[model samples]
Target chain A: MTTDALALPMAVPAAGLPARVRIHEVGARDGLQNEKATVPTEVKAEFVRRLADAGLTTIEATSFVRPEWVPQLADAERLYPLVAGLPVALPVLVPNERGLDRALRLGARRVAVFASATESFAKANLNRTVDEALAMFEPVVARAKAEGVHVRGYLSMCFGDPWEGPVPLPRVVRVCRALLDQGCDELSLGDTIGVATPGHVTALLAALEEAGVPVSALGVHFHDTYGQALANTLAALQHGVTTVDASAGGLGGCPYAKSATGNLATEDLVWMLRGLGIDTGVDLGRLVATSVWMAERLGRPSPSRTVRALAPTVASPASHKEQ
Target chain B: MTTDALALPMAVPAAGLPARVRIHEVGARDGLQNEKATVPTEVKAEFVRRLADAGLTTIEATSFVRPEWVPQLADAERLYPLVAGLPVALPVLVPNERGLDRALRLGARRVAVFASATESFAKANLNRTVDEALAMFEPVVARAKAEGVHVRGYLSMCFGDPWEGPVPLPRVVRVCRALLDQGCDELSLGDTIGVATPGHVTALLAALEEAGVPVSALGVHFHDTYGQALANTLAALQHGVTTVDASAGGLGGCPYAKSATGNLATEDLVWMLRGLGIDTGVDLGRLVATSVWMAERLGRPSPSRTVRALAPTVASPASHKEQ
Candidate 1:
């Protein structure tokens, strides 16, 4: 919002875009869990702290999946208390009652339940059928609500699954309704394979709205795997859906970090939103600095185009002659 | 377009989206020219041949710039005739009458003149001021028209120049009008530094339209350095512009390829257009293959997210054990 000379080129906001969007930062949980290296518990906590200091109001702290399933996040128990005092809503991923119990013990305020719209992705990710996974989350959601916890349902593969291609909108709507009916306060429709386009997003949001789910209760989770994440997010925003999930620096969570272009980079989204004159309450400069810090720790450049653009001196070590 | 299961997970065409878009393939000219390695003359023609085979109707063959200025595209005279027989419009870049003379002798049906919109870029790239560059191309465009060769004008830095913060929309409109008035059939607006967002694209397109430059005469050239190319392109598409300039596999020509993340990848654009159910005559599979082929020659992976997504096995050699 500062008229700083280096700020992104700002323009008048187009009609239909949200005046302000809430970015759900998933760097700690989704970004790191997939990373090849196990970030120290202290580093993970610092990552959360930096994200909050950068003006992020909602950050997914860590996932409570079994250590056997996600060894990288095995230190979630250690990660939780470290970030508990940050002045932000730190959410954690909880797949079942056992994971919910872990989050409850950590005094977590927000928890997200992960589900899939396709049978193949369900079986592949959760080792269960789609219906079985939904059934499994019922008890967890109930207990979380009973304990006054806010629940966010994540519908992975809501757009397409690697194994299933394009998921039927009706199936996604059905799963979404079930999650909302089961006490989830909101749903994050995920394009797990990064194959979604803006038209598909508009059509799907319309279907979800027609099926009686308010647009207010929906957020979008996209992967930049196909590079349409920002465009897809724009379509969703134009549909009046305000909350979007992004990972800082487009992190793939790979410790080796050769191919780390998974989640939409938060800096990219903020750049677009800020340029369109929309408010996100997030500071682009601080976010880029955070990614730069994390990339150093990971021993690789941040794959985020926005982060790299803002901090170009770090992306390439070689020099270019300036005219 | 086929109901074949692999047709991009397309939704019904949304309102305001063009049913069909003409993709101007720049892989051979814009892509390879900035590449660090000087691709063989035969391979340059082959790249254009492949792009046309992939259903690209407009492929810019090569630039007729001085060999000393662009050694990589030094074979433009050698490259033209090889692709002249193709059932596509082969446009070559002609900076002035000398370059136009090379195209004329080679029987080029279509040629493009490169101009800079900002004074700084004009002086740096064309070694002339903005008006001086426009004046320099006036006769080149006129002579090309007299010879019955269609001329396209490229106005670089239409949005922002690296040395200049944001080029005024009126300035872009004036340059665009001058080109169109100078007998140019179409003008492609180039965000040479890739700093534009959808909002800026929208505003600029609106100003251009208001200045009486028909939307049909406008094409957008974007760089993904900040990862906003597709989004900016979408804004132009929604404004009813039909031509889009893209390089296969996101190739950045090395004349300054080190800074060339400014062009949108053809595959990434196709994925969005196809998913939007917008008919682009280009084939996604064939385009990805072309990029993959070029990447091998370049000894690097394609920077395209769509190509990387389609050819994931090579991109992520690290295995993810399937259930």
Candidate 2:
């Protein structure tokens, strides 16, 4: 990208400053986990390799959750070893010490912890309250730190909860701080149901900054259920957050969350960032193409409007016709 | 709307400030024009009434174009007189002197002339080149002015043309200037294909201002084709343009522009504006309900994501059921 293209002429506000955003592709883990059919282990690993080959530095490999709870990702244990040390840090979703232990044994060096800011989401999703879930992660965080494994904390339902109404900003800030204090290197604030607007993101981020939280240590996960993900990410980027979690081709929606749609597509996010001259270092065309390929494997077209409109050749007409 | 809420604390450079923003609700005209099934004139009048009731003070109530071009709005002549002296000013879309004469005969005090920024879109859509189309509108605008009718000019394909990649900014500015000099009360820049971004909106508005076009006389018409409509609208709002063009439930798309989604939804725009504390005088629930009612008439769901997600008792179970 040209320096001239990146430079914003005249003085703009600091809160509105364009960010150099990096998208962490999470299709294999967070995306496919909610799929109706169980994706094969090789297919998951191949998806990871394709994302890695497309210049993605971080590809969430798989979740180590129990098979009974999430049958879709039951092959996590079998998939990890095959993708070890493939020029990218494969972060696996781990619920507790046991999951982390299993991931560590598979040669994993990065792990992500899942928690919810709302009590109802935590109970429905993990069968625990917010405090109970956090307590379970305390030991896992220490163990990961001792093993030299980086930890990332995902705080879901940070904006609005289905059972309850608008989530309090203070609660989100408190959970985020607790996760950071527990030794997680980065905290991703998730709008799991996609109810957030740019103003909500701005207010939440501003509240975080006001509470003395370092904005640079933040990441964002957004759902496109309400079609506000990309705009919300722009708001997050303006607040200086670097890492963003996205699903390839906008894959993945919370099956349990009736109002949920897909996560923000990596291609759409990359396209927006590139237009703003933000260096994401990912190949747009290749990333879009990979989503097209994944769409074929799942027997569906890619959910991302950008991928569908921009790259229509990932799967043959016959393959699409099979569905 | 509180003063504090409207303060866009997000940083934006001074040079990036957009010249102006205008909103034109096309629910009655362009939105209803493309419906395959005939919409009752009473329904169209009530639709316009509900839109104006929700603080949409400027509405495109009907079109005087040839019935062959748009049979859905063929009742424009009868509909115009029935809805006269509404709380808001009604703008009727006129294609040529004949349509302008029809509108004037029906007591239309405000009329809009449609032209394109590209030769290809102009020829394909209006059956004339850019210059020839403007020439057609020149006499119409003069006749409308003689009849004391306020004339608005619509410049389609302002950002990127479908046949021509990345429309030159100068070409856009020239069309805009010509419309202004030809006595257009305001100019609506249209991303008819929905391929524009916030950067493109900002650049185009800036270029227009640099070309000495009055910012207050500028409005925006965007399609959600790429899901950038709201963000692009925000960029325009930040530039101080107050008038924006939206369809109830994002209701319209150019039939010639294949794959183009609906226009920015009136419900979604009102939602975002309300969240930003921008007083649009639009009622979210009423706007959503009206669109949902209209969608049923069309045998489809409303295209607005906000309406789909936020409105209760409006979605058909089969609306999103995968084929």
Per-model DockQ against the true two-chain complex: 0.40, 0.22
Candidate 1 residue-wise lDDT, B1-323, digit = tens: 11123436555567788989999888888888766577988877777888888899999888999998888888887888888999999999999889999889999999999988888778777899889888889999999999888899998888776666778888888989999999999999998777788888888999988899988988899988788899888888888989999989998732322344637999999989888888888878777877877777789988888887676432322331111
* C-alpha lDDT of residue A230 in model 1: 95
User: Which candidate leads the pack in lDDT?
Assistant: 1
Residue B227 miss distance in model 1 (angstroms): 0.4
- Tens digits of per-residue lDDT, candidate 1, A1-323, equal 11124457555577668899999999888888876667899888888988998899999998899998889899999989998998999989999999999999989989999998989878877999999999999999999999999999999878875556678899999999999999999999988777789988999999999999999999999888779999999889989999999999988532212222579999999988988889989888878888888888888988888887677543332321111
Off by over 4 Å in 1: A1-7, A253-261, A313-323, B1-7, B253-259, B312-323
lDDT of 2 at B73: 84
Worst 10 residues of 1 chain B by lDDT: B314-323
TM-score of each: 0.93, 0.88
Candidate 2 chain A weakest ten by summed lDDT: A1-10
Question: In every candidate, what fraction of the native interface contacts is reproduced?
Answer: 0.53, 0.11
lDDT of each: 0.83, 0.78
